[model samples]
Target: MEGGRWDMLEWLGPDASISVFNYLDNPADLARVGAVSKSWRKFVISNQFGKRLCMTLCPEISNFTHIQLWKRYSHQNASPSTSMDWQILERAHIAYTYFAHCFLSCDSDKDCIMTCIGASSTDRFPVESIHNTLVPTDMDHMVYWRSSYWSSAGQADPNVQESLIYHLKRGLYLVNEIRIRPFKAFFQVGDPIYSAKHVRFRMGHSKF
Candidate 1:
């Protein structure tokens, strides 16, 4: 409050505060404001402000879920930049929904699901290998989806399904060999509206 206009910042709503803070060209300035108080900490953790800042600074991020979620949470008046393509928006929405579901599952422990949402290359990681090779046979965990690649026919291809199942099975087997619990894995190929150049992949772990 000494050297900064703290009173003005305190007057703004969460979204507006973030917008103003981000408008400052210096990252150090943003950090200073963020260190103000517990309320500010909450805003930072919730991504209420950082996400908006990102969207405002980089229009491309408007097509990401974190920004959209921040907008929805804050009820901010900001709109997606005019430059954002509708097709990209649609795909990002779908991907966000899938990720939201996965987050909910993780939070509730209802499904014991952990999702990996992103391009195909992004989701291709060895979980069992990372987890010391522990694999559960009965419980399945791991859903894969391709949001960028969709069939011209509008339905998912049998080949994609087969490939998902095969890799998932292999992954499970690797886990099993290490005595790890198996969690159900699901792979989705998201609709074309959400992805163009890259295929999105999602993974879910089920409790039952």
Candidate 2:
């Protein structure tokens, strides 16, 4: 031992130490490990444990080819040719670490939907627009409340279908469960609730 100090990384070797670190799913634990010493911090950043952990939690994150850092963090004077290698690594480390932290600490129970993009078909323009579906429930009244619920255009054939698109809230890095509450038309004569028999969800970045 050098100066009677214990070095776990030295004792375990690179491969074994990496395996041990890989088992840590918690981002906070990894941050603590990096805080242990300079060597530990370098090891964590060099191997990109934060990025790996993020990819493990959300596989879709791997699809990101590049991450745009905030303008405040960017060096105004520094050009691409003049930028130091260590500076780039530092930025990457920060980005991945933040991404992992946000993913791990996210509130899964909270609603992620931000805004209604559009619907495949609406019975009426503003009256039965998809935006009305955002409301939880309608008031107990006989008259139809245009603001309370959304209605799709009636389809004669069973083969015809309708769909909805919504933009999820920003900074919602992980989506655990998506809950859809179908509106029960208490205002209608029969109190019929329109809902799909089988629901399918598609997730991806917007083309726009």
lDDT of all predictions: 0.36, 0.74
Candidate 1 lDDT over residue span 116-184, tens digit each:
222222232443223222223222233242222211222345344211211232111001121222222
> 152-207 in candidate 2: lDDT tens per residue?
88798867877888988754244666767665666579988766778787777655
Off by over 4 Å in 2: 1-8, 11-26, 35-42, 45-109, 138-146, 206-208
lDDT of 1: 0.36
Q: TM-score, each model?
A: 0.27, 0.56
TM-score of predicted model 2? 0.56
Model 2, C-alpha of 49: deviation from truth (Å): 5.9
Which candidate wins on lDDT? 2
Residue 112 C-alpha lDDT in model 2:
73
